[model samples]
Target: MNAAPPRVLTVAGSDSGGGAGIQADLKSMLANGVHGMSVLTAITAQNSLGVQGAWELPEEQVVAQFRSVVDDIGVDAVKTGMLASASMVRVVASLLRTLPADVPVVIDPVAVSKHGDKLLGADAMDAVRSEIVPLATVLTPNLTELGPVAGVELRGVDDRELAAKILLDAGASWVLVKGGHDEGPLSVDVLHGPGVREEFSSPRVDNRHTHGTGCTLASAIASYLARGYDVPAAVGAAKDYISGAVAAGFALGGGIGPVDHAWQFRDISHPGHPGRSKQE
Candidate 1:
């Protein structure tokens, strides 16, 4: 058992463009040396530009998929992305409650896409805030998301802790207030746990090819947790991975691109020629 790789499960939507959502989550898990599983909540016709269309799966279908995995393969950690509606959110929350207490859970609380497309239904917001969020071991929300859920205007990095507190109050064991939306020299994330607070900072990569940063980061955190990192450690590791991915991001479509999930191997293996293929 010790020789096997950690297993991570992601409950989220599918990005047909293969840039974000479940696609990004699985890529992050693999990049971080973990096996990935998924229970799709919805499917979206998305590209680097934004989501064009989406449809949520039936609650029964979601439940069945979840059961198939947990009943057989099991998971070391779980991360959730887009739960399209209120009903889906409730079902997921209930399912997580049935899992073993030890397996950590990271909730990304995805509401909007990188291009500002609304991925979560307006009605589902309440269920996610109350029912689903409380079940999370760690709630990771970017500034755009934090502003609404925490109800505090985040002017800059200074107010991150306050936002984290608001999320913690809602029942998550810990809160990671993502500072990606802040205008700063560094991309910072504040991880606040019970009596524990820490900040993770990295050089904000200057790149427009950052389509799936949020989804990638949250799943990366869960991957680290599955590999046995404590909250702070997991977050730090995930930040580093995301930062590198961002730096390596390249144009994939007419619009924004996705972070390079395999950069660690690709860059290291081809040190002299980064972002170049044999044809180049």
Candidate 2:
């Protein structure tokens, strides 16, 4: 019998729009050649415009789903997105504590959605900092999210490095400070941790369809790590993948759309290519 493929489990919310949250995570994982599983923490009545409503699952239900998956399928790596509530964050952190310490955990401290909708509540941020972020093998946070976790305003490249350092000090094994929200022609991300700091640079893809870039990037990192890449290598590969996805992003609704997680399978063109077909 053939061995099963690498299994990556995502503990996150659900996006009804088929764009972000569990939807994007699974898409990115499959696109990167991994089997995806999920423990839904919450569900959102969301669309391309914005999130109209959200309902977080009870802590007991979240725990049940997580235990069910890890007890059977056995995740090779785990990626966590929006925990939604303080109680949910606590539950997830406790579950992580019980898991084998060697398992790679990618935490995307998802505070808000691409359309500026609040996903993680204000009270939950503290739970995420104390419980979740510290448990992460790699913590992926964009500029805005980093501000609260790192307690530093990232205004430039140097500030981004400082923000990474602060997160590492906060107990994350490694930190990827995303610069996609920063102002510049070059989108830079810095990966820093114990005795390691590396920078990844890509020309800013001038596209607005970036609804789920954070979830996609974290999922890609977890998938790559499940395939045996080290933290740095996995992050590098993930950066490349997300950069391509962002460049090929397309508009869906009235607001921001999603990144093309399956860019590898589609014959999409680079940002400036005029003759490229938008259809899959």
Candidate 2 lDDT for residue 177: 86
Candidate 1 TM-score, C-alpha based: 0.93
Tens digits of per-residue lDDT, candidate 1, 216-280, equal: 99999999999989889999999988988888888888999888888878745453223454436
In terms of lDDT, model 1 sits at 0.88
What TM-score does candidate 2 get on C-alpha atoms? Answer: 0.93
Candidate 2 structure lDDT: 0.89
Candidate 1 backbone collisions, by pair:
none
Clash pairs (backbone) in predicted model 2: none
| Residue range 1-280, candidate 2, lDDT tens digits | 9888899999999999988999999999999989999999999999999999999998889999999999988989999998988888998999998888889999999999988999988898888888887899999998889977777776666777787777787789999888899877899998898898788999897799888999999999999999999999999999999998887788888888888887777644554232254442
Residue 11 displacement in candidate 2 (angstroms): 0.4
Best by lDDT: 2
Q: Summing lDDT over every window of 10 consecutive residues in candidate 1, give the lowest-scoring window.
A: 270-279
